[model samples]
Target: MSNVFDGYERQYCELSANLTKKCTAATALNGEQKKQKVSEVKAGLDEAEALIRKMDLEARSLQPNIRAVLLAKLREYKSDLNNLKNEVKKIVSGNINPSARDELLESGMADALTASADQKTRLMTSTDRLNKTSDRVKDSRRTMLETEELGVSILHDLHSQRQSLLHAHNTLHGVDDNIGKSKKILTNISRRMNRNKWIISSIVLALVVAIALILYFKLSK
Candidate 1:
């Protein structure tokens, strides 16, 4: 079964190569020869297209798993066939020389193929930038989350410290009240000591004067 498909592929390749040669030879041809070559290439094209259809049908007869790979190859052949058709079309329409025709076709094909590659490259670049942006956004969000957590912790510690400070302030206020009461007691004691000293000094002076008068009177008598 696979051998049959292989045979078809081989035939198609040979025919395609021959058609390419004919198309090339047609560029140097003129008069009836060019028309004859073009007609022959057209007939070959139709036959090649028929082979492709046959290959398609044969690939379908294959096992489901094998069919996929063969189908893929068939698609490539189909594309190749289309490209050949375009070449013949160019040869027919432009009636230009071979070398110029090749260059023109190559230039056009290059532009088409290059456009696809350029688009892919641009898409990859955009995707890379988007991925980087996503990473940066994730990092920023994580940082913000950590900062928020740290802020909450710091606030909690500050609140605890404030409570401790309030407790200490209350304790110090009680001590200050005790100190004030003690200071007032000391002031009252100091005032009483000063008054007692003045009273004792006056009593001592009065005793001395009374004794001196008694002594003077006794001596005179």
Candidate 2:
């Protein structure tokens, strides 16, 4: 199992190296390099595809699981080849389209391939943007939920505080009423004591007058 994976890895590395070399050649070429590098790239792609097919065939003979995996990989390689071919066609059509300059001039298979490649690129870009927007929306929604929770918590706390304040106010009002009643009672007691003192003073004055009158009458007798 591991050996097959290792083989696939080696093949993948080789294919990557070959593509890189071809691309480098394409870059280095002035005019003739384009044709040569293009041909080389195509040939490399074809060889890689053939290798993938052969590997898939061998893997299929071994086991069902291996077959499935290898077949999937083989399909991927083929898809890559098709994509590269389309890209190459796009490049070719770009050159032809400018010179032909006729809208009715139906482009060849290469042109159609180029259009397909362009459409695929646009689709991929659109998909990426949509995914990004979706992720952002999810994040925003999560933040909003957190904010809503915070708001609910704050409201709960405020409600508790309000209840406590109301309870405290009611308790204070009861205490104030009790204090006012006590003050009124004290005032009434003070008023009663003042009235009793005044009454006692009047009685003493009356007794002194009575004593004086009795003395006068005895003297007279």
Candidate 3:
């Protein structure tokens, strides 16, 4: 009958709309919205099943071609419902949505990249500080070396001055010894001249006394 066919078409259109809503709910809806959508989908599926059963009973009274088309549509709808049920099961089992998973991955990768860049910056700063410390050490070593060289030069100058002072001291000691010997020689010459003068005066006095005694004896005779 025309009314029976029209009822079947309307039921098919309703079931298709319910399937679209269920798919959208499974993929897009969340929280209370998702729960409400799932309840609606389950009720729709039950109604569709009931409608199919009624159509199947009436289908036997139709033409063979009409019955075949209805049977095919029923089988297709049943298959789709079974597949959607499996999809819901997977969703309930905690399978992550692809879009959400991609977003989380991108955020994690950005954090990792930022952490790596900070580590690199810290390493470079440490390296620069180490280089500065090394340069300071090198400058200190060079300054120490220069100081050592200066110490050696001062020691050499001190040694030369000490040698010159020793030579001058030896020369002064030699001059003092020569002057002491010259003074002793002058004292010996003055004592010899005084002894010679005393001998000459004694000889002159003895000669004058002998001549006076000889003249007195002649006068007495």
Candidate 4:
């Protein structure tokens, strides 16, 4: 289960990094190239979104504490992906236009200058957003590592407790065997004592009969 999450996280980070680099490079390209890059970034975001949904489903089958952390992280990633998708769409639709200085220069000098400035500001904003997303990815990675470590510790403790209980159970079984042997020995001794008492009573009865016969003979003489 931990391995599953590890795989998902690795794939997510790799794809996200690739997409961010593409977005940065797109800023310097012409309209057609920028559109192509935006399309590619959108595809990557879609893949990442699928991975998050998979993680969310897996988390639901886990323990409550673990589920909560995983779900929270999933939500954060989903929100970031949504924002990224919107930003990429804006770029594609000319809302967050990149500089086309040479083409705009034919129109008028003032219009070209203003458009260039707006494009630069929008690019800067996009860069800032990318940096923030990178920071969040780092934080999420750290949290996942902590959660994995905690789960390992819990499993180790449970295994130790099971071993202790098994040892105690074996010890009690040995004690019960010793007690059964002692009871058998005591029963044999009791039977021997009863046999000795019966033999002594028979000998005393014979001696008393012999003494009575001797007295009767002496009186007859």
Candidate 5:
């Protein structure tokens, strides 16, 4: 989620800023420059570890929310499916009223099962993406911390911080793009479901009319 990434980005910015400040501070460290650099690096790594923990918690929270959404959708679909089955039984047994039975058979509830299946598929895809992104972020953060520990060169430290900032910026942009794609997919599915519902309604209405005419003729005889 953007929340988790934003948290990391905020820390990354703070770390980068601190690194810049320390570079200036390093110049006047006299005999303690190396010690001071190590201390700053350790502090930054600790901040990174804290950020990771926060993001991990956020990621774990997402799983339950996602599962709850999927479960709710499944429950709705199951209820709709049961209603659809009842409608089919009535149609077959000649128990359906001539008016509303056709709508039940053809409209809003007809393809509900299919939509539910699609939703499950989308949920799985989203889960996979979330996992992959989380892994990448964790790995990158670990690498950054490790790099920080490996005896920073004064010139190399500044350069690395600049690069790290740029990397973090680009990574956050990628996360934004991914979230956008997920949103787009969900929107398209919603539109498709609306169209399907309209079509199903018309078909059901026609079926209901035909049943009504047949019943009226039989009754007149």
Candidate 6:
């Protein structure tokens, strides 16, 4: 930016220097040379004035601080142009027209100010857009974090449910083992009861037979 502005400043300086040289020569020369020098000075002044307006327009695109500095420089260039115009006026008609110069200065300053205002408005609009974009990014990031937390919670719930299912399975397995042991114990008790019943029946039959034999022997005696 500075390079471009510096180029323009250098060009304006060269034009101003050339115009000054022409205005100075117009005073010391004869008929044709003096007229030619005056003509060159007028042409140079027009060119320098156009360049100043161009620089003013260019400054509107610069940073506000930089534009302010450029504007100050532009005003100084305008002053230089005014001085050159006065010199040319003296050379041609030996008169100074302050009114025309004043009107032109006021108009240029007004245009420059308008351009600066427009630049400020554009800068503010751009800043607003950037801030909105930043907010949207923050919202997106927060949503992602919330989603991640929800996913973690769901995984934890699944793990707990899995553990509960495993515990229930283990409890059912223990119950089945206890039922098998109880069935085995009942089968052993039934076998012991059948053996005792047969023993009691055999003992009762033997006693009855022995008592009958004793009665028969006593009758024979």
* Best model per lDDT: 1
Q: After superposition, how far is residue 168 of candidate 1 from its true place, in Å?
A: 99
> Candidate 3 vs candidate 5: which has greater lDDT?
3
Q: How many clashing pairs per prediction, in order?
A: 0, 0, 0, 0, 1, 0
Rank candidates by lDDT, best first: 1, 6, 4, 3, 2, 5
TM-scores, all models, native as reference: 0.45, 0.48, 0.41, 0.43, 0.29, 0.43
Tell me how far the alpha carbon of residue 24 in candidate 6 is from the true structure, in angstroms, after superposition.
Answer: 0.9
Q: Give the lDDT of residue 152 in candidate 2.
A: 100
Off by over 4 Å in 6: 94-221
Q: After superposition, how far is residue 100 of candidate 5 from its true place, in Å?
A: 99
lDDT score of model 6? 0.75
What is the C-alpha local distance difference test score of candidate 2? 0.65
Check candidate 5 and list the clashing pairs. Answer: 107-200
Would you list the rank order by TM-score, best first? 2, 1, 4, 6, 3, 5
Could you give me the TM-score of model 4 versus the true structure?
A: 0.43
Residues 1-221 of candidate 1 have per-residue lDDT tens digits of 26567668767766776776677677667778989999999999999999999999999999999899889988988987898799789778856766786776565456445544544664565556567877988999999999999999999999999999999999999999999999999999999999989988999998899899999999999
lDDT of 3 by residue, 134-161 (tens): 7988999999999999999999999999
Give lDDT tens digits, candidate 6, residues 70-94: 8997898898789878767776873
Please, what's the RMSD in Å of model 3? 34.4
The 10-residue segment with the lowest total lDDT in model 2: 101-110
In model 1, which runs have C-alpha deviations exceeding 4 angstroms? 95-99, 102-221
Off by over 4 Å in 5: 1-155
Clash list (residue pairs), candidate 3: none
RMSD of each: 19.4, 15.6, 34.4, 11.9, 48.3, 15.2
Error of 1 at 163 (Å): 99
